[model samples]
Target: MSRIQGPEPERRLARLFRSLAPAERETLLAFAEFLAQRGATTPEPHGGLREPIPVPRPTTESVVAAIKRLSKAYEMLDRGPMLNETSALMSAHVLQGRPANEVIDDLEALFARHYRDYRAKHLSEG
Candidate 1:
């Protein structure tokens, strides 16, 4: 069996926390708590929603590149809450040898779902 992948995420998260400025660090911590409270439901940072820029996926993409593309495409959606899920998928592919294509598929769906929630929340309020 493959060796267990463990504590890598925590280490990465600690590094990210250390790199952020104090206020930014607080924001990140708050976002993490929000995810803990709400599970998969992500909240947007104060902003307006707009049409996603169409970034056509390349016929070939690594999971990392696909994530970058989706983030650009759905720029309105906050990345904070999605971090947990995204990192999990990244670790799955990088550590467990999960196929890149499958990870990208789920990543696309995750971004799309966040975009939909963004639109619904903003459109309904305005």
Candidate 2:
């Protein structure tokens, strides 16, 4: 027997994903949520995925350099709203009066939450 294929195939799925506006993004996310629920019984191989591990005592220069790179990327994407004002906002909080590990923890959490929310909002939209 031959496998049946849908007329609207996923040949250019990547391009399709990028072309979606915010509302379309949400609807796609909704579909992903439906699929995830269907497979909920299966466990992930690793202990549930978690935040990135923080290195002990990151150097100020290294953190600043990272901020610079992130800022550049954020600008190029024209995504200033969530960009977190590199120096005065997000990175500053990380670099100021905090243990290196704590800073790393906070930054990692920030990124993870933002990404998760973005994905879920789109994948779960009806």
Candidate 3:
């Protein structure tokens, strides 16, 4: 007797995931959790996943620099819809004197959430 196969997409995804680095693997898992929580009334911050990378706290880093760094880190996310929220957070940090570390953490969460939303919307369309 032989083992049975799952759906083609699932098989393909598994293969793709197997080829990723440990950090990338964690990022993918986090994104999957985000997708799973899409229907919830209120989603938790950071999709409740372990931190994949340490968010850096450079002394000279501005909020804009943090946004750019996070954008590069989460390249899969769509940036257009996130502009408003990102701008607000940047304002809170710059004008309101919010701590850089806290603002950067929130920025990471924001990017993750937006990526989840983007995936949920587009994945269903295909």
Give one digit per residue, the lDDT tens place, for model 3 in 11-95: 8999999998874575456445444333432333544422223456577765556665675556555455666677677667756
Cα lDDT of model 1 by residue, 60-116, tens digit: 987766776787677666777788898788768766889989999999999889888
Question: Candidate 3: lDDT of 103?
Answer: 79
lDDT, candidate 3, equals 0.63
Give the poorly placed runs of model 3, Cα more than 4 Å off. Answer: 1-62
* The best candidate in terms of lDDT: 1
Candidate 2: tens digits of C-alpha lDDT, residues 91-122: 34443554444544554455445546645654
**Could you tell me every candidate's TM-score relative to the true structure?**
0.63, 0.33, 0.48
Q: Which ten residues in a row have the lowest lDDT in candidate 2?
A: 71-80
RMSD, each candidate, Å? 10.7, 15.9, 14.7
What residue runs in model 2 are displaced by over 4 Å at the alpha carbon? 1-61, 65-79, 85-95
Clashing pairs in 2: 26-122, 29-122, 29-123, 29-124, 30-123, 30-124, 30-125
* Backbone clash count for every predicted candidate, in the order shown: 0, 7, 0
